[model samples]
Target: MSSGGSTALKLNNILIFGLKLLVSAGSLYIVFSKNDMHQVGVTLTRIGPAAFLTASAMYIVSLLGATFRWKLLLPERFTLRRLFSLYMIGSFFSSFLPGVIGGDAVKAYYLNKDAKKLSLTLASIFMDRYLGYVALIGLGMLAFPFSLGLISGSPYKWAMPAIFGSFVIGSFLFFGLRLGKRFRVVSEFYEYFALLKDRKDVIVKAVLISVFIQIMSFGAVSLLAFAMGEHIPVKMVFLFLPIVSTITTLPISISGIGVRESVFVLLFGLIGVTSEAATALSLAWFFSSFVGSLPGLAFYIRHANKPEVKNS
Candidate 1:
């Protein structure tokens, strides 16, 4: 709240933004140096409009699943329809804004407006995100065997160990929450975990919904791959998408601009996919996701004039 704190925050943001831009540009440069721009452009041009539309539709359904998962975590004060709109607004910020944090901030703003218990509401949001990620890794592990053959000779093949390592670490931390009761931060997180554990049925339903959301995301990307004349296997998609999603979450790029393309080019190359086609697929996924998030902008604008109430 102090001027010095504000200045420090601004400097930190500027530094982060600069780093992201540099990383995005650097990754793109590396990818482009080894691939043909003209061919990639050609591949983009050949994609069917129908396929793109269908992918976008699938993305919309995935958004709904995401909303449902979050709703399961909330109390009776929030409705699914209302939460879905908020989620879209969050998505809009995520797509147009810089990083993952902004979107969640937006969601928090809307939820906190009507929430009588802001801490619980915030905890629900955190759990919703955590469960979704858990579902992604769990599904990725399920698809790992199929993906193993796909990753056999890629330069980034070590990504396998790295991914599993993260999962293992995450598991350890979740269980270790009990050991941090004296720490304020970990105590709050542990309380949220306890809240979820009390409702085993809700946890099950939320995880299942999260899995469906992942499937829908995979379906959207797989459709684009098919449209580009590259019939990507379902299991293969399960493997690479989680990795791509995980990498993009690093906040080292602007919405993963160049990072996604580079990962696609690297991994798809092993499966005989041309760099051009792979880039096209990545672009298609981005467009569908961005389009899906556009309504969030409208929602945000409409909500802008609404009066805000202080959290209770």
Candidate 2:
């Protein structure tokens, strides 16, 4: 890369990072302005250290589940421990740096540096993320009818539209990609798609692992809610969190900062939960995720000065 090009890329990243922070701060302000600050404070205080630790433990479990899923898609050359280290490094970048410059890119960067089959490594990472998303949407659809029974006349009456909208959009995208294989313009995408398509066993295994990843994720969140003294129904959490996960992934906010809390507040409101509790749950969940990623920083720094050589 030329010096000027490098500088331009750095500047672009900085600008996008700043914009993400601004969006997060602005959304947080709006959410906080409408809520009772006093109650939010009280709710935080009421959450004991024990509950926080419990949530952190669950977060660790979730990370392991994710690592397992990612490993399922990679070559045999990559060991479980090595993949876990790579995942941790990615998580470190993802948590500390939000927006376009995230852990996914970091994971791809390091892995590609050493990858003989760069395309396959990259495709593995993409499929890892894609399967997780598919599982999320599948869970949402599974929970939709049940959610309707639980969400009558609530502030979140509009959730029905959002849920159904996501389903329709996902279906369109799925079929669109399937049909897109015929076009030369998107041949690269189809190349990877075709590679994975022939591996039915790998796809099935990864999809199953993806389902476990979501279960662990929802478990972590449920533990956080439990810590906040709110017993949100497990079924309700399943129904709504997929929608929340999908929105927060949109990159409109920094690490989903304000968007996550706002969604929690809205969804929890349906069951008469206080905004304070909802906000606390969001923060707790964030903290657990942050803590879970801390080990990645050490791993990243340890590898910072290493020479980039392809693994044989």
Candidate 3:
């Protein structure tokens, strides 16, 4: 790329980052303006250090589960310990350094550099993320019927179905149609996809593990609610958390800070939770995950300057 083109791309990224920052700040402003700050503070204070540490530990366990699922999609050459390190580093980059380089890209870059098989490495990373999302959507759909009474009259009632429908259509187009087979790059990617497709056992195990990881994530959030002295039902947490997780994945705000808080207040409000308590719960959940990601910083520093070794 020419210097001018590179400069233009950097400027565009900067602009998008600025917009996301504004969105996060604006959303928080709106959320706090309408709720009682004193109540939110009080609820947050209810969470002791022990609860915070437990929540953080739960998040680490979920990351370990995620590492196992990703391992199922990769070659046996990648050991569990190595994969766990990569996962931690990826999480650190994702949670701590948004807009710099994405966690997935970081994982792919390091693995691809060593494995020297760009297509397969990239495909495995994609599959790891894809299966996790599939589990999240599936869980939300399963819980939708049970929670209909809670969202019956609200506009958000259709969100789960709409999201599921779109996912189904998109999946059909991508996998069924094999739309990009004509392109060399696309065909290379498809080669790895075909290999994974043939391994039914591996796919099933990965999906099951993904479900487990998602549930662990839900449990971590529930722990935070408990810490805040809010007795939100476990069923409601399972039902509503997936939807919030899905929406927060959208890149509308930084690290999902503002978007997550807004959704928590809205959904938890259905069960008579005050806006302040819900907001406190949301912040606590993020902080726990943030603490869990801190180890990735150490991994990054240790490995950042290491020379890459290409496997023959």
Candidate 4:
């Protein structure tokens, strides 16, 4: 690529980052302006240290479960310890450095450096993310019937189903129809899927592990709500959290800052939760996960410059 082209790409990235920052700030302003900031502060204070610690631990367990799921897609030579370290580093980058290289890309780069199979490494990373989403959406679908009373009049009544339908159709086309096989550059990428198509055992195990990971995430947030003296039902958390998680995954806000809080308030309000309580819960959950990601900084500092050992 020419210098001019590279510079244009950099400028484009900067513009996108600026737009996301603006959106986050604007949404946050709206959320705070409409809610009682004093109440939000009080709700946050209700969470004790034990609750925070437990939530943080649950978040870590979810990360570990995700590590195990990712491992199922890769070669056995990669140890859980190594992958967990990489996962934490990825989390740190994702939480601390938005609009930069994404956590998935960071994980792929490090793993590819050691494995020396860029295509397979990238494929595994993609599949790991894909399967995780599949499980999340599946859980949401399962909870949808039970949640209709809560979401009856809300836009999410249709939005959740629409999201699931799109995901199902997209997955079928990509995996069943082999959508990108004709493209030379991506043919190798699709080949990995072809190879794994018959590996039902691996895929099932990965999805099951992903389910466990999502449950742990839900449990973490529920613990936070409980800490605040909110008695949100477990089923409600199961239903609402997946929708919140899916929406926030979109690259619309900075690390899902404003978007997450808005969705939390909207969904939990149906269950009679105040905006203050919902926002506090959302912020507390993010903070716990942020704390969980901190160990990644230490791992990065210690191992980032270390020599990569090629697995035989």
Model 1 lDDT tens row, 47-162:
67788888888887888999988878875546777788889898888888766358888888888778755666677888888889888878888887667766776656567557
- lDDT for each of the candidates? 0.82, 0.78, 0.86, 0.88
Candidates 2 and 3 compared by lDDT, better number: 3
C-alpha TM-scores of all predictions: 0.91, 0.86, 0.94, 0.96
Predicted structure with the largest lDDT when compared to the true one:
4
TM-score of candidate 4 relative to the true fold: 0.96
Q: Which model scores highest in TM-score?
A: 4
- Per-residue lDDT of model 4, residues 1-312, tens digit only: 999999999999899999999988998999999999999999999998999988888888888999999888986479899899999999999989965768988898889988788888888999999999988888878888888887688776776688898898998888778786887646888877778877999999999999999888988988999989999988888888878988888898887889999999998998899999999999999999989899999989877678888765
Please estimate how well model 2 matches the true structure, expressed as its whole-model Cα lDDT.
0.78
Please give the distance, in angstroms, between residue 61's alpha carbon in candidate 2 and its true position after superposition.
2.1
Please give the TM-score that candidate 2 achieves against the real structure.
0.86
Give the Cα RMSD of candidate 4. 1.3
- Best-first order by TM-score: 4, 3, 1, 2
* Candidate 3 accuracy as TM-score: 0.94
Candidate 1 weakest ten by summed lDDT: 303-312
